[model samples]
Each structure stands twice: as structure tokens, then as C-alpha cells.
Target chain A: MKQDSESIQKMMIILSKGTLENVYAAFVLANGARMEGINADVFFTFFGLEAIHKKKLEHLHVATVGNPAMHIPTMIGGLPGMEALATSMMKKEMEKIDMPDILEFLEILTASGVKLWACKLAMDMFHYKKEDLYEGVEDIITVGDFYNKSQGPGTHILFI
Target chain B: MERTIAGNTISLNEEGYMTNFSQWTEEVGKELATEAEINMTPRHWEVIKYLQKEHQDQVALSIRRIGKSGVVDIKEFYQLFPLAPLKTATKIAGIPKPASCI
Candidate 1:
């Protein structure tokens, strides 16, 4: 065996939530992996598909309710416009830290050579067509295909 | 630690990044690029110059900013310096490795 077989060679990140925090977390991890010279691929499924949905990507919001990290009471977090307010505030903070907005981030990831794959089952459930997703997405693939793509030692699968 | 490159002693951190930007020169940069398995070309020099200028101006470097630098887009930047482009380019440019995640 090669002496460096233990080192991570690739990252297979699975994103299942539509929350802005989760989406950004997935994006940062994938991009960070590429920054380190490790291969990375993102698999978007369930509500995560919204992240690649052209019309909805820019509108993603942070989850206020059920998220104790926000520190607001559940009832208050559930109020109308609360999510938007939190999302806008979070976006401003992100911008200050040089975080790109969703649309631009997608472009950056594509240019960085991170392959983006949508879950085939999720697409059928959501009634989404190939054209509905961001142009950078490579394809809608089945779980089996994902596994096949993940072949080889040192490859890891991460679900977010 | 201090090491000799291009016949001059230079300081570097544990990660092999040059500690003092003042010690950097075209010769030193060429040596560093060779160490990183890169061949210095006019195109590569343009990126290194841009990176050094950004460092001098105190601009925090990131892939996003470099993509928007107009000196090179992200695709061309990656093509110019494959693998870890930011880390490799910055190292060859004799600047600290950027702490950017994106």
C-alpha cells in the first residue's frame, strides 16, 4: 500500500436541509476541501434541492424556530417575517466576512471544479426539471450511482 | 526557521511559508515555485505580482476576491496553479497562506 493511503483523497458531501446555515455549511466544507487539493462533490437531496433551485436559492432563510442557536423563543421565531429578518442580518454578517452570496457562490464552486449532483428521487418528488436547477449542477443521479462514483479508498461520504 | 534560497537566508514558518515578505524577489520566487513543482512563466508571474500587490495593500485574499481581481478569473487561476491554487500561489508569491475557506 502507498504510505499516504490514510490521507483523505476526496469528500462526498450530502446536503438534505434547505436552511441557509446548513446550505452554507455544506458549501464551505466542499469548497474548503477543494482549497486543500482534495476532490469534493456535493449531493443535494430533499429540501436541499432548494439550494440549486434558481428561483429559490437567493431566497433561502436561516431556520429560527427549532434552532436553539438563534437564542430566540420558539414562538417569537415563528412569527411572520422573523426568518427573513434573521436571514438578512446573517447575510450582512456573511458579506462582511467576504462570504459570497448564493448565486455567486454556486458560480465559484463550479469554477473551482467541485462537481454538484442532485438526487434523482428528490427531483421526482419535487417535480423539478433539469432546467429548474442552477446551470452549474452536473446532473441528477441515483443513490446507487453516487456510491459508484464514490469508489476507491480514502473517499469519504458526509451527510449534512 | 531560517533557510537559504537563492543564496540568501530567509525565515519561514512551520508550513514553509516565508515569514518576511521583504526577503522575497523574483529569484526567490522562482526557487519557491520549483520547490512546489511549478514552472514560472509570464502568466504565473502576473498572478504572483497580483498576489504580492494584494498582500502589500492588506487585502485579505480569497478565491472569491481573486476571481473578481480581473487579473485572473477563478478558472484561469486554477489552470495557472492547479491543486490548491490559493495555497500554492500564495506560497510561491512568498505571502502567508490565506485563511479563507472559500
Candidate 2:
């Protein structure tokens, strides 16, 4: 399709990290894009699929393993209670800015017309059923389908 | 910088968005539209009016919100403003650049 001269009509964001910061960035950018009148979609894969999973989403943690900010050795990330501590701290900071929790943010994005998709391969590997995901997920599509749907004039594909 | 419209000095930011919206007039709108290379039409005026009102209300303006306001649908908004609808329309309407714009 031929695009209009200057408007960005479509945006595709691929979420590969379930970390709080990454998920937050994806939603912020998607919301901003939709606010600009662009059609936006987010495809969740691998660890990212956990973001849309109902049970997992509620307990999202900041990835401490291999995270340079953590400073401590990566092995410390495997210790118990670290994830819970990080999750709480992140949530507290986000609340200061009036940003909703991850689950609420996802619902707001969906209500605002941002398409959500789960990767089929990830679902199969993780054994995630459609019912296990949040209500707004459109479908379990392969990466190829994502590429095909994202193809068009002024389409922006971003991987995060 | 400023543009004199109808004997009124309308102050504008360095980026050309109006700093004082109260100084905006139809003549000023026409001049701004021309600078953006858009020929003024009633439909364009509709959007410009709506944008000005939203700015006064301190509402965050977006294409979807504009469409929901019944001023115009997203497709028609793009058609009216051509490239960069929100940016161009807001500029023509004498409002600040939308936060969503780069």
C-alpha cells in the first residue's frame, strides 16, 4: 500500500523482555504512538510472553540476572526473595508518577486499540493456553504472521 | 519570533507554535496554515477549532481523541492535514507541539 506522504500509520513493537522497565517502555511508546493516531501492535515472545500471562503478569520482576545495574554477581539473582523485593521497589517508584501497574497498563493499551499478540512457538514451549493470557490478546500468531501483518507503508517495527 | 496578523503582534515560540493562544485569530490561522503549505478549508477549520479548545482545556490531544471528539475521523484528519496530521494541524492551530511528536 502506498503511504500518505508524512504520517506514520502503523507501529509494531516486539516485546522480548518481561522485565518491568522493558514492558513499561513498550506500553509508554505504544500509548504515545496511538495517541498520535497511529495503529500500534505488540507481539510478545519467549520470556516476553510472561507479560501477557495472567498469573505471571501480576508478579513481574525486574530482571536482576545479567542486569548491569545490579552490580552484584549474576549468581546472586538466583537467591530467593530478590525478585519480590525488586518487584515491590519498581512498583513503588512507578506509583510516584501515577503510572498504573503493569496489568492495568495492558488493559488501558488494549482499550485504546493497541493490538496484542502471543507467539505460538513460545506458547507451545511454555504450554500456555489461550485462557491463560489476559483478555485482550488477539491470537497466538507465528513470527511470520507478525511480519506479514506489519508489512505496509510507513510501518515501524521495533524489538524490545 | 512573531507574526503580525490584523495589526496584532502574535508571539510564537522558536518552533513557530503560538505562545499566547489568546492572540490567535482567523487571520492568524490562515497565515499559519499557509506557512504549513495547507490551503484553508472549512474542514480544516473544524480541526483547528477543536484543537484550540482542547488546548484551552489542558487536555492531551491525540488523533484518536480528535476522532472521538467528532471533529473528524483519523483517516479524514490525515487527508485534511496530509503529512504529519497532529504536528501540522497543531502547528496550524497555533498550539504547542504534541508530546507524542518527536
- lDDT: which candidate is best? 1
TM-score computed on alpha carbons, candidate 2: 0.68
Mind giving the per-residue lDDT tens digits that candidate 2 earns over A86-155?
7788789877655777887786677567899999999999999999999989999999999999998788
Tens-digit lDDT string for candidate 1 (A36-126): 8888999999999999999999999999999998998999999999999999999999999999998999999999999999999999999
Interface RMSD of each: 3.3, 6.7
Docking level of model 1 = medium
Give the Cα error of residue A15 in candidate 1, in Å. 0.5
Report how closely model 1 matches the true complex, as a DockQ value: 0.64
Deviation of model 2 at A76, angstroms: 4.2
TM-score of each: 0.97, 0.68
True contacts kept of 2: 0.00
Pick the DockQ winner: 1
The worst-scoring run of ten residues by lDDT in candidate 1 chain A lies at A1-10
Runs with alpha carbons beyond 4 Å of true place in candidate 1: A1-3
